[model samples]
Target chain A: EAGVAQSPRYKIIEKRQSVAFWCNPISGHATLYWYQQILGQGPKLLIQFQNNGVVDDSQLPKDRFSAERLKGVDSTLKIQPAKLEDSAVYLCASSSQGMTEAFFGQGTRLTVV
Target chain B: DQQVKQNSPSLSVQEGRISILNCDYTNSMFDYFLWYKKYPAEGPTFLISISSIKDKNEDGRFTVFLNKSAKHLSLHIVPSQPGDSAVYFCAAIWSNDYKLSFGAGTTVTVRA
Candidate 1:
């Protein structure tokens, strides 16, 4: 079975610029998630979508970050006015409904200079 | 606040020795625990997991032990292999929620 897929394995943007990351979840998976992993830290939940509707986004920094899962199969995470602190790996994960374990993608390494 | 904690930033062990990584969580609401392994430039992959109803779960050469009262969990890799050298993260989920809370992670280096 194919795993979750993400685009632009690496990205570099200047501070205050806008950047977007894309993700395509495993086929038939209904739950999708976006996470941020800073250096030396675990992946922190940014947002979760269960069939195109948000399940949780309490940890998301709404002021600068936004994400959407259109049609519940693919997702996009965007950051506007990116700051140096936004430099990190953006990971996309997905799991089938009623499952606890999630499958991950290679992730996009974003560096905001 | 960081609810889940993996105090040991790194561990090194002989190739044939056992490797134990520890994790603790302050949230009593967490009911399910999991371990994920990650290589450089790759996203984390699920390794093993344990539910609150059980104290231990084993898969192949990997084992997960959970101590509910202590709110602590551990992962054991038997006869560690060179390929086992990677960052291991502990994650938890609470009742009625699917969002996972993760620990900082432990980097294990298995030496040949």
Candidate 2:
């Protein structure tokens, strides 16, 4: 079975510029998640979607970051006015159910200069 | 506040030796625990998991042990291989919530 897929394995953007990352989860998985991993740290949950409906996004930065899972299959995460602190690897993962083990994608490494 | 903690940032062990990585969590509500392995430039992959009801779970050469009373859990790799050298993260989830809280991650180097 194919694993989760993401686009633009690497991205470089200037501070204050806008950037977007895409994710396509595994087939038949209903739960999707977005996470940010800064250097030397573990992935921090940014948002979660269960079939196009948000399950949790308490950690998301509403002032600069937003994400959506249209039709519940593919999802996109966007950051506007990016800052140097936003430089990190954005990882996408999916699971068959909310409580099950998740499979992850290669991730999009965003470098904000 | 960082709820999950992996105090050891890195560890080095010889191949064929046992590698033990430790994690501690402060949240009492966390009922499920998991371990994930990540390679450079790659996302973390699930390695093993244990539920609150159980103390241990094993898969191949990897074993996860949970000590609920101590709010600590550990991942043990026996006869470590060079391929096993990577960052390992420990995560915990509440019983009613699917959101996982993760540790800072521990990098393990299996020297040949």
Task: Please list the C-alpha lDDT of all candidates, in the order they appear.
Answer: 0.95, 0.94
Worst 10 residues of 2 chain B by lDDT: B92-101
CAPRI classification of candidate 2: medium
Model 2 lDDT on a 0 to 1 scale: 0.94
Q: What is the DockQ score, from 0 to 1, of model 1?
A: 0.79
- In the range A1-113, model 2's lDDT, one tens digit per residue, is 99999998999999999999999999999989999999999889999899999999999999999999999999999999899999999999998875658889999999999
lDDT tens per residue, model 1, B1-112 = 9999999999999999999999999998888999999999899999999999999999999999999999999999998999999999999987476778899999999999
When candidate 2 is compared with the true two-chain complex, its DockQ is 0.75
Native contacts present in each candidate (fraction): 0.72, 0.70
Output the number of the lDDT-best candidate: 1
